[model samples]
Target: MKTSIATVCLSGTLEEKLKASAAAGFDGVEIFEPDFVASSLSPELVASTARDLGLTLDLYQPFRDFEGVGQEKLRQNLRRAAAKFDLMNRLGISTILLCSNVGTAVSADDALAVDQLGRLGDLAESYGVRVAYEALAWGRYVNDYEHAAAIVRAVDHPAIGHCLDSFHILSRGWDPAAIETIPADKIFFVQMADAPGLTMDLLSWSRHHRVFPGEGGFDLADFMGHLLRAGYDGPMSLEIFNDTFRRTDPFRTAVDAMRSLEWLQELACQALERDGREGSRMELSPLPTMVAPVGFNFVEIRADDHRLDQVRTTLHQLGFTDAGNHHSKPVELWSQGGARVIINRGDSTAGSPAVAALGFDVLDPELAAERAGRLLAPPVPRDRGAGDEQLLGVRAPDSSEIFFGRVGRGGVPAWVSEFGGSTEVTTDPLVTRVDHVNLAQSWEYFDAAVLFCTSVLALDPQPSLDVAAPTGLVRSQVMSTADGIVRLVLNLSPTGSADTAQHVAFASTDAIGAARRARERGLAFLPIGENYYEDLDSRFDLKPEFLEEIRELQLMYDRDERGEFLHFYTESLGSVFFEIVERRGGYRGYGATNAPVRLAAQHSRRPIVAAP
Candidate 1:
């Protein structure tokens, strides 16, 4: 599948944008209207440069509020569109994006809109250019793919086709299954993006907050699966509009965009295979296949002190039963329902408690390891013994060992079973498979970790950033295998000293529900301020009750054109915390706005040390 990006996604001079897109490995680009209007380069020059750089001009967008206008106004809009099409022809492009009439044309009747679109399609055909009809989430009458496709089908012109935008389709809550019904030939273009779900004014969010796929919470796999199943073999393009993404270094942003597409491609392939569709082998696999494909399998906590029993007791009260002690390892498993919590004694010599390692079950341990190895480095040999002990280990970029195995042999410990004494029979059921792993690494080892992940584990590297803080700038690098299952985030301390490894983020279906359940079980969490709610109310036009609930839960949030996201920081366990995310629609992203707030919260909770 050929991949492309919209020129508007990158922020810079036209030359820089073109250069960055080419460098990032895009086959083509959808030129945003602003980029084209602002460009100093002539259409012919731009076309020549794109050819020299081996990039195609996929589409020019977006002519908005063009249809259903008064005759004179419509004529003028048509003339303008014609000029744009001429320029596109000069630039050797063949497609133009026509956003459904929003504000001004929303009230126009469907028949009028169809007639106007048919005229535009006829005009486009005159120039040998195709018109891609897109449904804007905030569009007037046409806001969903089904509605937009109806218009396209009603026009019944060869020049008119539908553009499948994952963001718009998902953000509007349109069923992804609809793609299966549309004729593949009519799928002229495809746009993909991910954003964290948020409660904000959709217009404002669309203008300033979009995330790359995999960074947000959209089931792109399902969307892509539907597209592929329909035999829609069109150029896959990315058109993201995010304030943070625009402000970030253009080059790095381009690289990350490419990484996201690669991740999505892998995900699409896997989903297709699972659904019994024919596809090629995966480029990389980041997950182990030992357990069921959902929920937290186990939580690993590494501590420097010998508080395994204390920690175990805490887990016990939360309804967890001890699995069994490993004869050769210094680890013990505790379980509740399908969730397993592994307590690692790796740092027992030190007084601080930290998370050491995490394990996930996979369908095939060796294949998963091999796939992971291709993205980073070869897997390291792990010891295996008789009776349910079969497992393989791989080193992530952050130097943490990820163990993949089937169910262990031994039964639950008698003490734990007896202590928990209940009519409930314990059964070893596979929980949620491993989603991704985050790591906190020291500055000195940052480069080494990156190398390890790339050369040893064979994961793709994302652009690194140095976040400025009161103490100093914290540099971090994130690497993920092509399959999108394994993720390692390596963070370096600003002080240039060895830093403790801490913090983790787990994926979940419902954060609000999970938070409530965790609270009921006595898990402590930091409280969000009412001020955030006030800001949320003013920033987003959401209902008062929903805003109240979010603020009451201390959930941090932000939205983009794609979708919304929610976040919360845990109490200080050093500088570490967990992010529980629940994606609505197609949003995918960590709540970036909450980062500073969370950091400040952590700073406030830091223990005051006395001078010796």
Candidate 2:
């Protein structure tokens, strides 16, 4: 599929946006009128520069408020459109996006609107430009795609056609099936955007909250499926208007936009294949295929000298034994049950005891890296000494490293051999493998993180949830592999926090028993309020003794149609926390229902300082 992005979606000068778009492998750009008006270059120079960068000026956009007005006002609107057509001719742009009258539309007469649009089409035809008319979600008279389509049909002019924007249609709750009836030839342009479900004014949401496809709540693949089924073969252009994207680096945002389109096209093709539909003009790119992880290889913790001993002691309290030391580096290996932890001292971590890296046991490390490269994930380099096995890792948006390696017999590498002593230790361990890793992220980087996991790591994104915090609502999502081997919980941190803290949850056969044992070992659990148990009793039909046991253990419980989830947390070890969890009868959820209580407890413990 040919990919294009709106110039308004990026930050920087027009020249920078064009260059970044070209470098990100986009074929064309939709020139927002404001970008051109503010540009230093002339229209001809802008066109020539785009040509030099191998980018096409796909569409000259957003000639707004043209139809459904008085006769004198209609004449004035035609003149305004004529001026833009002259500009489009100078810029070598063949199409103009005319959003339906969001302002200055006095008459709601359909015949008048049609007559004015037909006259404007005649004017556009004089300049060899086509008009892609779109309906604004909050337009004065035309607020729906079906209504706009009817106006286009009534006009029946060759130079005027429909511009289908996913946001405008999907946000208004319009069914896309009606699109199949609109002739493909009449569909002039297709613009795609995804957004989180927010209850707000439509214009405000459209302007400041649009996100890249697959990063939000919209079912874009289904929308694309309907577009493809209508035989609309055109550039799959992006028209995003996000506050964060407008301030981020232009080049980085351009790359992210390109990745979103590529991922969307691939998903659309998969949908088509599933439906046995053929004759699609789009072709999926060769991205890295999804590989199911056998399990977590290890979790690396980075610490400085001051916090090193505290980290070690905390691990001991939680039943981890120091197994061995790395032969060449200042690192120690610790183990409990089948889970491994690497404590790398002296690494320049953002905070004390931060999760530095996650190692996954895949089928082939080299092949996985190759796949990641195809998906445009940049590789991060590591310093390896002599006889050290090479590892393949991709740097995440939050600067965390994710490494992949082979695990089966004869396929495993000897990187662990560099450790001096035998890593094996025998003990009655309480926790087994890693259940999940919760990565806290800033709101600006949340979309990038979701796209990274879904596109590069081949994980499935679950519906986003809002967790109540002491400060505000925290947006949370869970992405996991199909076979339940790898699970990542991404939380958008509460605003104005110093830093986003990370947590690791380990699985156990009996979470209550593990919590009791750890408490007996002198581990200070994050205390829960008695009111929580009272509320829990009201929510669930549990016996009095069971509720009392939960209250004593300070454990959280959640149940759904599938099964039950029980978990308990430890007090903060610097910026990191730990959780022991048990899943009963295929429960596939984190204890989200208990997040408010946990957040309130944590907030109550925040150390306060006297003002100077």
Candidate 3:
């Protein structure tokens, strides 16, 4: 695929945007009109810069409100089109995007629109430019892409064709299969964007909420399939208008956008393969097969060299056994049953304990890592001595390392031998394995993290909701595999507070017994208020004895038609904590409804200095 991104999708001067796009491996760019007009560079200079950066000026946009007008208005619009065409000539761009008239169109007559578009096409032809007429979702009359295509056909001018925008088409709930009916040659340009499901005015959503493909709700791969099945082979461009992207570093945003396109291309390729399109006209490079992890191999925690004793104490109290240090590194393993936690005292200067990396057991580790690499995840290089166990890793958007490991015998990683090898030393273990991991994301990169989980990790995202916190509302999304293993909860902190610590929730066979044992071992339980238990009784009217036991244990509870859930949290130890959870019957969720209460409890016990 010939990938491109509009200059509007990033934050920078025009030259900076071009360079960022090129550096991110874009073949071309659509120069959004406002960005060009605001730039200090002339059209020739901008074109020259794009050429120097090894990029093609794909398209110039957007000449708006050019059709369905009276003769006088038509003359003025043609004059405007002439000016833009001249500009495109100077920029060495052959295509100009003319949006279907959104305003100032005096008529809705199809004949008038066709006639005026023909006149504009003549003007474009004079400047050796092609007009890609696009339908705005909120256009006055010609709002549907099929309607715009019909107009283009009636105009029958070689200079005029249809521009298929995924946002405009998908946002309006138009059937994309209709794209296959339009002749491929008539489809002059394609701009792809995705957006979250939003309830707002069309213009407002289109202007501000558009995200790169795979980051939103649209089925862009399906859209791409339909376009490809129609034989349309051209630059697949991105034109996102997001507030975050507009304000962030252009290079970073460009890389994120490029990653989205890479994922989208892979999805489209798979879609075509599913349809048995073996002889595709476009030669798309095939990506490695996606393989989801079967289970977590290990969760690594990093802290100052002398600061890990507190975290280690909590783990020990919670029934984890010391599994000894790595044979070659400053790392110690703690385990409860099959759940392994690696305490890495690698940087003594590191501030507090945090989840530094996660290793998962996949059927094929190298294959999974290769897929992640193709999806634009930066490969994480691990420093190792000879004869060390090699774990392939990639960096997530939040800067956490994700490693893929080969499935070991009896759920134990083969690399455990690199350490002293003792783990959980228990017949009837308290914590069985990692039930889920909670990662805190910065507000700006929350959506990007969601895409990373879905695309790079191959996890499916559950419906997202906002959990009330003492500071502000925190958006939480749970991503997991279909079989209820490998759950990851992503919490977007409203204020980006480091105090919003990352946690690992361990599944217990008996939550009550485990809580009692940990309490006996002196685990500092994050205290729950009496009113919460009072309200809980009102909500579920539990047996008095069970309720009393839970209150004594400081456990939180949630029940659904499927099953009941019981869980308890450990007090924050620097920037890391733990949760022990039990599911009775067939409970599938992470007890999300109690998140606000948990957040409140954690807030009530704050005050962590930067010092470890």
Pick the TM-score winner.
3
lDDT of each: 0.67, 0.85, 0.89
Locate the minimum summed-lDDT window of 10 residues in model 1. 411-420
Q: For model 2, where is the 10-residue window of minimal lDDT? A: 408-417
C-alpha TM-score for every candidate: 0.56, 0.91, 0.97
TM-score of 2: 0.91
- Give model 2's clash tally: 0
Q: Please give, for residues 1-612, the per-residue lDDT of candidate 1 as tens digits.
A: 677898878879778899999987788888887887788998889988988999988988887888777788788888988998888889888998888877566345778888888898889999999988898888877788998888788889999998888888888778988888888789899899876566786666666666777665567888888888877777888888876566556776776677667667667876787785643222333332222212223557766555555565555433456766665566666665445566667554745555655565444557656555443333667554433345567665345676655433242222232122234545542122233455677533344465445433446667665554445566666776554555666777665433323565555556676566556766557666667678778888887787777776677778877788765545545434455556666664455556555655555556667999
Q: Write out the backbone clash pairs for model 3.
A: none
Q: After superposition, how far is residue 349 of candidate 2 from its true place, in Å?
A: 6.3
Model 2 misplacement above 4 A: 107-109, 346-351, 384-390, 410-418, 423-428, 498-500, 534-553, 558-563
Task: For residue 375, give model 3's deviation from the true position in Å.
Answer: 1.8
- Give per-model CA RMSD: 13.3, 2.8, 2.0
TM-score (C-alpha, index-matched) for candidate 3: 0.97
